[model samples]
Target chain A: MSEAVEIPSGTLTVTRPIGVQFSWRKAIPWLLTGPLLLFMLAFYAVPVVAMLLRSVNDPTWTLAHFHALASDTVFFKVFSNTLYTAFTVTIGALLFGYPLALALVRTPRWAPVILIMILLPFWTSVLVRSYAWMVLMGRHGLINEALLALGTIERPFRILNTPLATQIAMIHILLPYMVLPIANALRQIDPSLPRASSGLGATPWGTFRQITLPLSMSGVAAGMLLVFVLALGFYITPAMLGGPREITLSMLIDLQVDQLNWAYAATLSAVLLATTLAIIGVFYRLPGVSNAFRMGAR
Target chain B: MRRFPSSKHFSRRTAMGLIGAGLAAPYVRPSYAQGAWPEQTSIPDILKGSGELRIATFGGTMQETQVKAYFEPFEKISGIKVRYFPGTSAPKVKAMVETGNVEWDVAQLSRGSIMNLQKQGEYFEKIDYSLIDDGVGKEFRFEYGIEMLVWAQVLAYRTDAFKGAVPKGWADFWDTAKFPGDRALLGTTGGGWPELEFALMAAGVPADKIYPIDIDKAFASYDKIKKSVVKWWDTGAIPIQLLTDREVSMTSVWNGRMAALQAAGVPADISWGQGLSKRDAWGIPKGAKNAANAMKFVAYSTMAIPQARVAWGIPYGSVNIKSNEFIPEARQAVLPSAPAIKSQLVNYDYDWWIENREAVIGRFNKWLLG
Candidate 1:
């Protein structure tokens, strides 16, 4: 330093050799990213782009389909109904799922058996499960028959082909999706934190509200996000169980496809995709949400 | 950053191109060979020889029994083997036709599909009038296909529930107060069209005047009965089960299904009065791989003897005049093609329905959703 040695101008500048050395490390990262990039470009991006193009650009590049979607009362009604149903089901699943998940986490010894019970219905085909619910909720179904035997009602209850039936079936089908994640999140939380909080003159309820819940928020959010996204695309359960008045966007899409109106179907699909993305975007913005969700091994 | 040479991309592209080429290679065969169309005489030759002839149908016990009774004997006599593929829906038929890799030579199609396809152009080979028995041909004639079986969509009721006060006809079916409790109807859009048409007729729209049905009026009538309709069954089995289990007091069920329920001692009875009878027909695809064999299969399936055998096993009344001779007089009353039942039954105007099917179904779905 004291000598103030004369430095070569080229040495001060980043040389080609240094650049090459730096790029060599970057090469492996690019190589690793290449397959994923190509996959996303081909499968995900291309299809989504094609769908969007089809929705607005008809044979002559007209927005007739989108206009139809906007102008039509049926479209708006069904779209709204689909969202309303998804939201309600998500809320219902969360309300019911959280308690069950909490219970499962606290359950000692027989937890695996309890977990199996939760997963049992998931093993069956959705179509079969829907049909099973149809029979169970039918006019002269088990519930009605039992009620009649008990002289609770004079007539058979008409529960089949109703929104109530649709919701019940959907909740039963989607409960596992919510439970597994929340349970996993709860199970991973250190018991010592809650114990330490309680030792500091905090009530069990307060400790749960402040510590356990905060820690479990990641799992809860993840489960909610998963269940809500999945609920948006539900077709079979609603179709089989729900009445005509309870028709969803999926049903409308199905009808359009069946009638060979692919353009309209594409439009509906695009709307569903957009709505789902918007939901995910909103979810990502919630405080502590990103970090809370970051804990789990997805 | 250094740009890497995309050898991986090139390899992938090359691999995809090779696969595409391999997939397209089989389709390079000449569209129409000089000897491709089986000579008209091959039908008789195939009938005489011993080989398997595949017959496709909308499969059920009824169709299965018919296949056994009709195709099995034909196989034994002609030494032709028989295979069955259940033709489930119109889309399935379209798929089979467009693919040109037909698994089933002869397929049974609903009258509506037959009319639609016929209007679309010659999907099936035109029948040889000379080969057909005049009496049999006259009875079971269609422009593009031959009638295979006839079944009535009749009012079925639980005898125990209805007692002696059974709903007689379409008018009675619409009357929920008199014949109360829950009702079941078909959930299919196709099924709804015929029901709405029948409802209009029951509301006193005449048979000949049934064309250009008032959609609003039909839906108004449907709305009245909609509340009483506890369930809309999608499959053939559900209506029968609903009646058998006493889940619903009444339902519109196919005659064969009702017969099956009655046979099972479910205390269910069907009314043929003013019943809408659907005629199922046999036809070959437009560019069928085995057109000659398909024709032979169709001809054999529609024959009077086979038709009679089919009628005897299944409740589907045969279109062939000779089938009546095989059926006992007491049992004939239950048959859709019987003189008494046929006299009261409304022969659906297939031409009008076919032309207006899409429009009518669209309106029906809108009404259903509303």
Candidate 2:
């Protein structure tokens, strides 16, 4: 039955009472996704599934590729190197980026300028940044020339092909990823909680320790995860800036694929994907990350 | 209204099935072949219309040289429009061939690529040798592909490195005490060919005595000089950059790249001595659209004059022996097939690569990690 009702928002309406009524027609808009889903299936899912399958079925079924990956010191060494690089880069970015992010939040007048400076590097091509690092790090590059001119270091030092160079370049490239998320999370604080804590005889350090730090954990965790994951899969920077000992998993995959060793390539890729998932799997189980996930799902 | 639950259950089942299908479709999907390719032997017949031919090539200056020598001439003669996709890789070709939805009408394939994909079976179309000119060598010709060009991985060094005496070959390149500067060399992980040959040669094995390569001695030689080596140049451009920048005074690089760098006044020079010369070929992927037109394109590109023109443009050698007659003698010096250069360069054994490259690269990567 229809009834005239005037209530919320100063509006009047005469409408049927709400009840359970479903129609297949309501879902018709969802059908529009058919082509896109098909496209993803055609271009994405198929190749990924096929590659995963190839890891096992390639050149006759055997876990030999996996065994090689497990037993071989090369694979193990690379795996550990990649993990180490990613972890180091993550920590480096957090230390550098967290302070920058705090400054960005505190000085509202300079926020845009600081943000532009941080994001300017982010917007530039990763390849360009890597090449820039090369110019700065080469044998007679600006750093060495400057050092020579300054009379600080007598010789042009070697830095470009070392793990240190890789770390520096990677941290530079990924700093913004860590900064933006943490800055956004910092911006979300009520500002009252800290004030109220300080008013109740709590010291600034104690207030930050109990309230602000715990609250920002989600962003920190997310930033670390993002930077770590990206660092693990890095190819161009490592290939361009780092030498043999710095070779990562993605580079290994590229090398294997170029050699037309498909099974080996697939295995490496599968392991990378599995490792990424495993890391995320462990991460999601953490209190801060699980909270972030639950919030994201909402 | 009363008949709803059963049909609703049926509808839900249908949706579940549809979602399952949408997800699973591409993985289990059979090849959906397109185009009506009637059998024909004559390449000219394939090109008699205003149809288009698609080619896959690695881009940058390589494609630029190819367009000048191959595409322009073929298009002008055949009245067919040429379309190209750059950075087409072997893995992409493998995916296309395996999926049976081939994209390119023809592809530029490296020796490793051809052997790798061909060994997998029916990945490439069998060539009709009749369409191509007879000038292409029998050794270079294949049932599935036609040799396109020859390039060598050669030794290069900064001209000022040795001052008075030049480093003669890989042996001198390895003798850091004699020449004395930071050096660069690629292990097998860097597409290990010429390096292996160089290693064997440095260990006192002659070029002729190189293959069925004594892996043990080569590695031992590698061990001797590994400490002196500053870096392993992974990409083709790195070696030249290293030499020009004086990061490494001596390094190994592709001959053509060194020529380009020298032309650009990089103050670097190459030695053709004991270079690892290899050939690259072009083939149509299985079930390609306008495949016949692709064959015609490959055929025209392999002709002596076209081959010579491409070689002259890029300084890589033409696969066709008769291309020498077409190329001027000044240009011949840079071409790997030039009598003087050819005498010095050792042809890379692709068959040996097929048999041993995997093990070599594996061991090489392990050695590098160690």
Best prediction by TM-score = 2
DockQ for all models, in order? 0.14, 0.23
lDDT tens string, model 1, B258-364? 66566556677887777777787777666766666666667666666677666666667777786676666766777788888888777776666777766766665
**What residue pairs clash in candidate 1, if any at all?**
B50-B79, B51-B79, B51-B80, B51-B81, B52-B81
Query: Share of real interface contacts recovered by each model?
Result: 0.11, 0.39
Q: Candidate 1 residues A58-114, lDDT tens each?
A: 566888988878876767777887777777888898999998899888987768877
After best superposition, candidate 2 residue B33: deviation in angstroms? 45
Candidate 2 clashing pairs? none
In model 2, the runs with Cα more than 4 Å from the true position are A1-20, A23-46, A57-65, A197-210, A290-298, B1-50, B187-194
lDDT, model 2, position B103: 91
Chain B alone vs. reference chain B, TM-score for every model:
0.82, 0.85
TM-score of chain B of 2: 0.85
Q: Ten-residue segment with the worst summed lDDT in candidate 1 chain B?
A: B1-10
lDDT of 2 at A219: 74
In CAPRI terms, model 2 is classed as: incorrect
